[model samples]
Target: MNRRIVLSGTGLVSAYGSGVAPYWDGLCSGRGALGPARRFADAPGYRGEPVGEVPEFDPRGEPRKSAYARAALAEAQRSARLPVLPPGALVILVGQAPAPEGGGQLDGEEWELFGPSAELRPDGAAVLHLSHACASAAFAVALARTALAAGAAPLVAVVGASVLNRYEYASMDVVRAVARTAARPFDVDRDGISLGEGGGAVILETADRARERGLRADLTVAGAACRVGGKLPAASDPGAVTDCLRTALAEAGADRLDHVHAHATGTAQGDTAELAAVTAIAAELDTPEVPVTSHKGAIGHLLHISAVPALAAAALSLRTRIVPPTPGLTTPEPADRVHHPRAETPYPGLRVAAVNSFGFGGNNATVVLRRD
Candidate 1:
């Protein structure tokens, strides 16, 4: 039906704090939030690695992931002026498989979905769970748009959360993916990811419905594309990323992008591959100087829910016409084609922005957003 979908509201709870204001401010301030990880301090094999942890979070007898989801969802609905979810509204819960209890590898049956869907979904509401590693949230956004276009629901609320837990932290530690200090995306001396925990939510609806409800619709979900490269879990393929970005741009009918929210996780392989992909796409589109930024440097890698914060940053950039600086980025690796800004910059021609999210097992997704 070619229905037009728009982002009506967005909520974020990150290492900086809850609410969009704090998150945006922290990003724009150009300071890394990586600090000592207290969550796993006393656990065996703990090595005092740094992490971007949410402060003062108390789950209060509920799963930390569920608590984060509920907080973010509440803010999103309130921002949309939706006191109650409309009947038949679809809720997409995006995240990774819960950390195994008491250590040891989890079996297939232990991979059941977890989130706040049980508490948030209203009567007649349908719930869907997506666990595509780091790209889960971006994939969820794309699915929500599709459902709305197909008239399967009047609206969709996509909520995602990834809290640092013992088993998951140990897994990354075992692989040496968790940075000893901080994540420095695009930097030549970059090491590994500073894992973070938080939640994010976005409300999407048709432009017609937003207008009918007298809600502002300034950002449009212009395009989305997801792909899988047959690669190892920890490796990234530049070719796959380039293909995904090209398809997303094609779907958006955009020839040039003003800004690119990158998925650089500070790993040597991941950052290099993403840069190669962006360089190729920039050359193909003749936007060689497209500004590229990554939130991982500021908030650390949020893992499965990382895309939500990046998407929220893209939406805010589109609205403000300013690109936030990449925190922890100093002495960026030489890039001949694209500009990686270390300071906040204004993009007078800002209109279209792309958010990239790459996950374990070569899952890649790109979402193109347009300012209306």
Candidate 2:
């Protein structure tokens, strides 16, 4: 029998604070955490837009990214009431490997910190790092589903982290991709992406195991699909994203989705391309227009493991039956099939919600989540 993969717990570290409550509260309040960049030493030299740096992060000695990952994982483990594994669980670290300057092989150290199970550490537990730009977190969920279905492990722990430092901020400046004003998804006057730093984690388990432990699953990983763009790191191909979404929805047996968590960075080309793909799918299926949202407008773009926080928010939406507003999404264009919500809209009977994540290397990943 095929086991259903479900999300059991969540952890988050963002500009708002270190736990899931702060992150979700910030979203529901419709107040963005974006402001002047203070985490970097070379902030004054940055000619780009304001950034949403995590507050009080003083990376004096440790790698900034590792600190973010550790906090998120700790909270996730605690929330899930994770017990010591008996040499059968898997740990997937969803983040880019450390840069050469930072250090070498820190993934293992991070995993050790997150998963303290000696039995699993010796042989059962292994760390896999994905560097698929922004889609890394979404890919982690897809991998967890595959592992659970194959019975490779009874539980899969996915933790993701990403940060914006001086080096990366300068890189975005060179390409003129940094937003001059604010991160506005699907808005007519939107300019570019406002880079941000944050990360989150989620614990996945089989439905049978969750029931055995008397845990209520917030959302199930129904289906997922991934695709890559061709020869362009800065551009998104609508056709590829469309194909990926189509495959994921079809696999999930969802002809219509209630909500869509779009990976819209607020860039002109990026937002337009993604919405076009979603529009095509909606038209092909003849489904009602789906309410779409992008958290980047509120938290800025959390590069690399951006999808982790998005997945957490999607799960929360499923649990609470409310979809938070995509702050700064005022005056959405009328041409797109996906409608940008203006407030914290209550979605009754939200069975399925689709999430899209696109990476710089043309990686497009779609995850379909269902409640009930």
Top model by TM-score, which number?
A: 1
Over 4 Å off in model 1, which ranges?
A: 98-117, 231-235
lDDT of 2: 0.76
Screening candidate 2 with a backbone cut-off below 3 angstroms (N, C-alpha, C), the clashing residue pairs are 229-362
Q: List, residue by residue over 1-372, the lDDT tens digit for candidate 1.
A: 337899998888888988888888888889777788776466555678778888887767566777888889889988888888899999998876534444246342232234443555678899877888888888898899889989999999998787776667777889889887788988999989888888899999998887777887768999999886645454378888888889999999998878889998999888888888888988887875988899897777888889889988999999888898889888889876889877778888899999999888778899999988
Candidate 2's TM-score: 0.89
The prediction achieving the highest lDDT against the true structure is 1
- Weakest lDDT window of 10 consecutive positions for candidate 1: 108-117
TM-score quality measure for candidate 1:
0.93
Residue 259 lDDT in model 1? 86
Report the C-alpha lDDT of model 2 over 1-372, residue by residue, as the tens digit.
448888877888888878888888888878888887664545544764667778876545555566677677778777777764336777777655533433335463343222112121325666666567778788888888998899988888777666776556666787888888878888888998888776677878888777776787647899999776654454378888888889999988887778888898888888888888888998887866777888898888887778877887888888888888887788886655677767778888787988899977788899999997
Each prediction's TM-score against the native? 0.93, 0.89
Per-model CA lDDT versus the true structure = 0.83, 0.76
Cα lDDT, model 1, residue 225: 94
